[model samples]
Target: MDRLILADTERREIKALLNVSMDIDLNETKDFELSVHRSAWDDTYQYGGYIFKPGTEIGGRIGRLNTDTALETVKVCGLTWRGMLNRKVIEPPAGQDYRRISGELHEVMKELIEPEFEGLFLVSEADTGVTVKNHKFERYTDLLSGIIKMLKSVKYKLRITYQEESQRAGYVLVEAVPIIDYSSQIELSSDSGLDFQLNDIRNGYNHMIVAGKGELAERNVFHLYAWPDGSIRKTPYYTGIDERVYVYENTSTETEEVEEKAREEFAELMNRQEFTMNTSDLQMEVGIGDILGGRDYLTGVYMAKPVENIIYTTDAYGTMNVEYQLEGED
Candidate 1:
C-alpha cells in the first residue's frame, strides 16, 4: 500500500472544503431565546493583632466593607422568536459571561442555524430482466446533484485504485494495484431546488448510486452504504460486481457465457466500469451528549490501505505492512 502524506495547510484546506460541502444554508424563519441571571454578597474574617496581653496573645475582629465585591448569578430561559432567515451565532469568548438578553439572542441564533446532509436513495434487488434506468441522464449538473445527494447521505470517503494490465504470450491476466484514497465529504445546498430530508436517518437504511469514469469500465453498479455517525471506516464495502462475484440464478452454462460476453462488451463501451459497495457499520458513532459540556471531545475518522500483495514470476507471494505516526507542531 502506498501512503499519501498531506501537509498541515493542505489538511486545513481540505477540512474547510469538507465543512462547506456538508453545511446547508437555510432561510426558514425560526429562533429561540436564552435568559441569564446573576447575584452578589459579602463575607468577613478575623485576624491576629500586633498587641500582646500580659498573659496571652491578642486577636482582633475586623469590620471592613468588601468594596468592589459583587455577587454573580446566571440562569438561562429559552424563548421562541421569529426571523426571515437562519443565522449563526458568534459566541462570546470563554471567560466572558452572557447577559440575560444576549443569552436569549444566542439561543435564537443556535436554533436558526440548520443541520446538514438531507438526501435519500432507495434501492432493492430486481429480477435479471428488469430494465435499469439512469435517473439524471445527460445533464452533468443534474448528475452532479444526484451524485452529491447520494454521497452526502452515505458519507462516503472516496478511494481511487488504479492498475495497469498487460497481455503476454496469448495468456490474459490482469494485475491490480492499490492507489490513493481520496478523502472528501458531500454537501447539499438548500437553494438547489432539490427536495430532501433527514427523515431517512431515523428510518434505518438507504441506498445510492456510484458512477465511474475512465479505466473503470469493468465495475458499474449502485452501491448503498450507510454511516449513521458518518464513520467512513465502518462504511459498507461493495465493488458493485454482483454478477462477477456471484452465481446467477437459474442460468445455464450457455446463458453464463452470454452474460460474460455482454459484460465484456459493456466494459469496452463504457471505457471504465463503475462499481459500488455498501456497509451497515458506517453509521455507528458517539452521541451528541457524549461530547457536549465536556472538557475535551476527541473524535477521529480512520482508514486503512493494503500496502502489498505481490506475486512474483517464481510463484512467490509476499505482503508488506506500514504504520502511521503523527509529529507535534513545530
Candidate 2:
C-alpha cells in the first residue's frame, strides 16, 4: 500500500485556483474633470513649489558645484471662488431684504451639484462666478445620498478623468468595476459535552481534532470558516476528549517489583506515541458525516491571506490599466 503525503506542489496549485484578481483603471475618459479638480484642490491646499521671476536676484549658487550667485523668486497667484446672486423678484420690507438675498444665494448654490457646474467652478478664471439664468434650483440632497449608498454596496475598480471646455462647461468620467457582497456561516460543537465559543472575533475560526475506533490508529478532522466582513459567533457545546491505552511487553520481569516498574515505563511510552500520532494525523475534512462524527476534542485555528501585488499602467493619451492579485490558499 502507498502512504498518503501532502505535497507542496499540490498546495501551490490549490492556492492559485483560490486566488482573486482585481483590475482598476484610474483614468478612462476624454474629459479629465475629476483629475483636474483634484489636482487644483491639492495644489491649493498643499503648497505648490515656488517659481523664479525674470531679472530678480537671490544670493546663492544656481549651477552645480559653483560659487554663490544671484537668484530671483516669484509667487504664484491663489485661485478662489466668490458668488453673487441678484433677486429678480423680491416682495419684502426693509429688514426682510437681507433674508431674501440669503434665500436667493442658497437656491443658486443648489445648482453646484451638477458635474458640469463643479467642473466649471474648478477650472473657471479666478473670481469669476458662473451664473444660472431662468433656472429653478432643485435640491439634490436625496440624490447625492442615494449615490453614495450605491457606491459603497459594491466593489469597484475606479477610474476618474476631468475635462474643461470653457469657463462654464466641463465633465468627468467615472468608470468603476461592479461590486459584490458574499457571506457564509459555519457551526462548531462537540459530542463529549465540551464547550466552545467563537463570538466577538471578527476573523473566522478553524477546528481540528482526532477521532476513530480502535486503540492503534485514529482519523484527523478539520473545519474552517473564512468570512471577510464579520466574525463568527458560536456558543459553547460539549465534545468529549478521547483517551487511548497502550500495552507494553516486558522480558525478564517475573518479580512483583520488576512488573510494577515495567508498567510505569509502558504507560510513559504509550503517552508519547499517542501525542506523535495525533500531531501527524491532523486533517481538514468537509462533509455532513465528517462534521458530525468528531465534534468533540476539537481545537480552533485561524489563518488569513493577503493580497500580494497591484500594478497600474498608462499610455501616451493617459488611458490607464490596473491589475491586482491576492495571495491565497486552497
Candidate 3:
C-alpha cells in the first residue's frame, strides 16, 4: 500500500498513516480519512497537522479524530475545508478586460495572501491567458464565495498545491487553471474498456426572480431566465412555457450585479448532466476539470462533460481503484 505522511505545518515530517483514502472534487475541497489500530494511536496526529504524500502536495490537515473502543480502532478525518473564509471579506475594485494573473487580478491575489488570508495562502503566477469581463467583487463579500465567482467568470477552477523541494516549500500555491477540453483526444466508449452509466434527470425551475440587498420598497430586484439550450438571459423568449419560477436572494445592491450572480447560479443548477464511470480497466490518467467525450450505444447519447469529482482509494490488499463523476452539458 502507498504511504500517507503526516507532516507539521512547518513542513517537518511526522509518522506515516495507515489505511488512508482520499477524495478530491474539482469544484470543491479535498477530504481524506484514515484509521489505525487502537494501540497505534499517536498524539502527534493532532488537528491542523498536515496529512499528505511524501512527493506530492495533495493533502489536507487533520480535522477530527475518534476512538472506537468497541472496534479497537482509531479513526481520523483530514478535511481541507475552506469554510473559515466564510467569515472573511474582500473588496477589489471593479474592472473590465482584465487578463489572468495580471493587473486587477494580481492585486486581488496579493490582498488574499496578505491581510485577507493572513498569509496562509499563496497564489501561482501561471497565466491561463483567459481574459475576464467586468470583474467585480461586491463590497463586504465573503472571500470564499467571491473567489469561486471570480474563477467561474473566466471558466477556471481553483487548485491548491504545495512545493516539496523548491524555494517555496511548505507554502500552499493557489492556481487558476482553465477547464481543458480533451474531447477531441480521448473518447470513452464500451469498446474502450470503460464501464459507465448515465442518469439524466430533468426537473427544475427555468425562471428566477432575484432579490438584491435592500428594504421592502427600495429592494433591488432583477429577472433571469434559463433556456433549454444552456443559455441564461435577462429577457425571456417565451411566456409561461416551462416557466417554473424560483426566487434567488443576493447580497449585491446593484440590480445588474444581482442579475449576473443569479444568472451564473441558475445556469449552474440547470445546465448539468451526470454520469458515473469506472476507470479501473483504463490505462490513462483522467484528471479533474477535464472534458471527456463519452458515447453510449444502447441509448444513442453522446456527452462531452467535465470530471467534476473523483475518488482515489487503496484497499488493504494494495489494490488501487479510481472512480470519476462527470457532469455538465456538451
- Per-candidate TM equals 0.13, 0.20, 0.72
Q: How do the residues 245-322 of candidate 2 rate in per-residue lDDT, one tens digit apiece?
A: 233333343333343344335333321111101111222322100111112233443222222222333332344343
Whose lDDT is greatest here?
Answer: 3
Q: What tens digits encode model 3's per-residue C-alpha lDDT throughout 157-266?
A: 65555545445435556677666777788778999888777666466667788888888979877778777777888778535665678889987445556665677788
Give lDDT: candidate 1, residue 219: 39
lDDT tens digits, residue span 120-184, model 1 = 01111222221212211111222222322222222321111111113311111111112222212
Greater TM-score among 2 and 3 belongs to: 3
Q: Worst lDDT window (10 residues) for model 3?
A: 96-105
Model 3 TM: 0.72
The clash count for each model shown is: 30, 27, 0
Ranking by lDDT: 3, 2, 1
lDDT of 2 at 268: 32
Best by TM-score: 3
